[model samples]
Target: MTAITGALAMAVAMGLGRFFYTPVLPAMMTGLGLGPAEAGWIASANYVGYLLGAVLAAYGWAEGIERKVAISGLVATALLLLAMGVSSNVLVLAIIRFLAGLASAFVMVFTSAIVLSHGLAASKPWVQSSHFGGVGAGITISAAMFGLIILADSGWRTAWIMAAVLAFAGLAVVMRYLPRDIVRTGPARKEPPLAWTPSLAALTIAYGIFGFGYIVTATFLVAIVRVGGGSSLFEAGVWLATGIAAAPSVAYWMPAVRRVGHANVFALGCLVEAIGVAASVLVPLPAGPVIGGILLGGTFIMVTAFGLQLGRQLANESPRRALALMTAAFGTGQILGPVVAGYLADWSGSYTWASLAAAAGLLASGAIVLIYCRPRAA
Candidate 1:
């Protein structure tokens, strides 16, 4: 019961915070009078905030700070979104989005580290992964609301406001239920009296690539499909839901992480991601979108889960630095992904090149995982 409670709290914190962005963007543009460039910049600004917030929560405040970080982050994110309701300037909106993004990142880093190190202990991969399944659940909620709610003529801003209301309500729930005594561990033991080995470096670099590749699809997949004989926003919504359905790989990979190790799980997930991306271009149909989204989402979360698992393993149970590196690498990729996709979309007026780039990045991540990370017994 305690574990389930913890997972749900963390899930709401991470899932609700991160999953509602894209759906709300269209409305924001239409009603809020945001230009395309502005919308994109705001999205990217959020990513930047995430990068900074991740850095702070992952390392600088690893001890006695988890609950404070989580609580404060959730509250701040709610406020930032709520504030956008009255803010007039694009500059103010961007700043608020960035801060919201950062708050989400802080909660994510803290909650994820807790789940990985404490909630699931060192033996329960399935538990941790299932917790990640909350992301998909949260996305489903956002998608459903975005689709059903005919908010005011105000467009995306209204949706953002609604999302803010929902998230704030969630924040209240988390505050009421979240545990307080998160035992902060000391400096992690070293695998061989060294923390920054070449393998770790390789893993970090590969994950950076993973971030870049995954975002290309995640940020633009719906648009890409719409371009290539795609269907309505309804169809895109279905595809997104399918992608969410695939988010439980964290649980699926848990046993493998215990039996095989983090490296193999990470490598395997990346390899699958590469396959999914390639398949996306080749089979850009309804079934194709469904398959690709499921595969891609599953693998992506596995990489995320295993990254933490491996960092914990390599750091001799201390994951502060490795986790920080992983978050930064992935966040950097996410920040660049949309820009690269947009550039490609502009240059070719099609999604072929962007999807190709995504495939290439996934392949690169897989290769790195194979070379540097392999599954080991937990």
Candidate 2:
């Protein structure tokens, strides 16, 4: 029950709150006459809020009230979605996205703390995978909703309203099923501090690189398809493909992790995702986006899970802090990716060069992880 609830929470927070923007972006652009640069700024604003939220979550302030925090974030996310629906101004949208990003990070950090801790206590590690899968599930739902809206000839504003309703529904389920006992209301127990190491540092940097590399495609894939003259249905289908691939990625990659260890699996995922990112723009129409979305959906979340898991192992006693550090690094890269890609797209009139550069970053990220964080012999 906890695992299912956790997945629902993630679907609401990440899939709808964070990424619904991608599918809706094309419509917003068409309706609002937004250039790529403006879109990039709005995306960056959300990442900036995410960064700040990560930093805040690192402080152990929510030690006994993680559930409260997570619930608050969900509420904020739903409200922000509605706020987005009512606003057409660029600055207002950016501000709303920024707040939404903050809410998302809070939900992510707190929910993971809740679900992963429960999984550990129950000796059911698969719970973590289920929790992560919520992201893909949410994305699938968003894509379907947007596709329906497009077919109905409804505008982006309606899409945002629909997102808000979906979020509220998820919130209700989460509130009902997410265990209240997980909250530790007694005095906080002391844990060992995180011991920073060279390998940890390298992993952090690589994680950031992965963030930059993947985000370009994640943010703009739908737009790219639209620009390539694909119909609205095709664009939604591509995004749907991505979500479907993402749904089981963690389970699919677990075997590889056992065989090659976390760092190796992380490195390999990066390489695979890099190919997808480059292919999104470099390859031609239908095949390009389809292959790109599948590979990307197949790898990004798996890599994300491994990266956080590795960070937790390296931190020893301070798993939350480690998670926060990794999130901060990722947020930094995310903040840069869309803005850079957006401006580059505006300047070049295509996403090719920006995407290639992002792919290069992913390659470098893989190399760094493989070289610096390789597993020691048993």
lDDT of each: 0.66, 0.91
lDDT of 2 by residue, 81-185 (tens): 999999999999999999999999999998998888889888898998999999999999999998999899898999999999999999999998887645343
State how far residue 308 of model 1 sits from its true place (Å): 1.5
Best by lDDT: 2
Segments of candidate 2 deviating more than 4 angstroms? 181-187, 190-192, 376-378
Cα displacement (angstroms), candidate 1, residue 42, comes to 2.6
Name the best candidate (by TM-score). Answer: 2
Quote each prediction's TM-score: 0.85, 0.97
Clashes of 1: 12
Q: Which pairs clash (backbone N, Cα, C closer than 3 Å) in model 2? A: none
Tens-digit lDDT track of model 1 for 1-378: 334544555445555565565555544555666654455576677778888877665555446667777778888877776787667687887788788778878777776656555654546545576566666656666666666564323355565677678777777766776666454445532223336767777877887888888766665555445545654464437545644665566776678767777777777787788777766666857666556666777777668767766766766544666777678888898788767766776677665777788888888887887776653324
